[model samples]
Target: MKIELAENYGFCFGVKRAIKIAEDNQNAATYGPLIHNSKEIARLEKDFKVGLTDDYKIFKAGDKAIVRTHGIQKQELQELKDKGVNVVDATCPYVTKPQEIAQEMSEKGYSVVIFGDDEHPEIKGVKSYATHGALVVTSPEELEGVKLHEKIALIAQTTRKVEDYMKVANYLIPRYKEVRVFNTICNATFENQDAVRKLSKKADIMLIIGGKNSSNTKQLFKISQENCQNSYHIEDEKDLDFSWFDNKNLCGISAGASTPDWIIQNVIDNIKSKIS
Candidate 1:
């Protein structure tokens, strides 16, 4: 059996930036999980003393509050600032682009349409920026029969697949007079997806590693599964099932943007030990 790793996998620029920010601001609390990987968050907490807080109100006036990479709702951010908390923005630049686009386009009287899961923290924050409210949908069918303005501004969650986002855009372009589509997908996501897709096709077994709640990780798994039926999404080495690799000639491994190299290496090491 052979083990192969995807060309582009593990911590992306944004996740690396957020990790650095968290390290620099020891004793500060992030409003949400700094990134999707719990193990990395635990590592930061243990080493840097950085804390996680679900409620923004818990911070005192002098306390430092680091914004999560996914960002927070506009009103929640404003409220935190109004309380005089020392705010440190660690929001990914790619995520911020959609938020700005939503706010600017909505103010210009364009109906905002976001292609993403409405319940996702990134989408929730981006949607909150739309002055007149934004419609969130997963597929082109969701836009069916929905009455939108003549002019529409479409944005997507940074981690969503470009193909899916295009389906939403294609649906609107034919119906509306003017539809402005913004490519908000992160470059790292594009690379990781493509790499996994390619690797999965050649491997007998594929492992997509990252947080279970990570949207991007799930996307990678989805793509891997499409190409290779024997695909599993695992957080770390602990989640590995050795039986899956039985008689498998090639094992492909890809990690999400938020996943750390340490975890990926651990998975590789464990697999090597078990199969050697």
Candidate 2:
């Protein structure tokens, strides 16, 4: 019986910074959910006076607000500042890079086309920074009705799969005269997927630990499932069904970008407890 683990797994730099910011500013009422993971959010809620607001209007003077790792638009941030809220910006540098790129490209008269989930907060933030019209696309199939402008720029969500972004870029490159593609996918995500793909080859079953709503975590699950049919995505130890591992001895564990190291350690400990 062997338990394999992905070489690069758990919290990425962005998630780490966001969590730390939320934790350190416990004296003030923290505004907005820190991360997508419910478990982590719950832990913060228990420790600090966290404010759950759908809009930034709830923020007041002397209140502490956490700029999530995904980030917010400049205007929204300015509004927060004007309202006299103390903002702890935890935006991931990789995610922030795309916003700056979008701003620069848009200023240069390039119609920006971002390859990412439109509903994602990160994408929304990136789009808001575009001085020119910004379009979001989740797949190459969505390129059918896209109209070309003279100058075009393409960037991807930081957690997006590299192959998916490349495919989208390849599809758009033929139609536009001037197309600039920035492979904005984070290095951590790339390395994590590579590790999962490699681990899948040897493990009998794969256990992915992360929130289901997390984009990067979902990507990891998708990639692992493709390679190993027995792969399972679970948020924590409670979701683990030991029956699945009854006949399996060699299991692999991997987590999403939003998953904290403590959660991953807990899952590992639980699994070991059951096996022992």
Backbone clashes, each candidate: 0, 0
TM-score of 2: 0.95
Which candidate leads in lDDT? 1
Tens digit per residue, CA lDDT, model 1, 174-236:
899999999898899999999999999999999999999999999999999999999999999
TM-score of each: 0.98, 0.95
| Local distance difference test, each candidate | 0.94, 0.85
lDDT over C-alpha atoms for residue 143 of model 1: 87
| RMSD to the hidden true structure, all candidates | 0.8, 1.6
Estimate candidate 2's RMSD in Å: 1.6
Error of 1 at 251 (Å): 0.8
The local distance difference test score of model 1 is 0.94
After superposition, the stretches of candidate 1 with alpha carbons farther than 4 Å from their true spots are none
Candidate 2: regions farther than 4 A off: 29-31, 48-51
- The deviation in Å at residue 262 for candidate 1 is 0.4
Model 2: lowest-lDDT 10 consecutive positions: 25-34
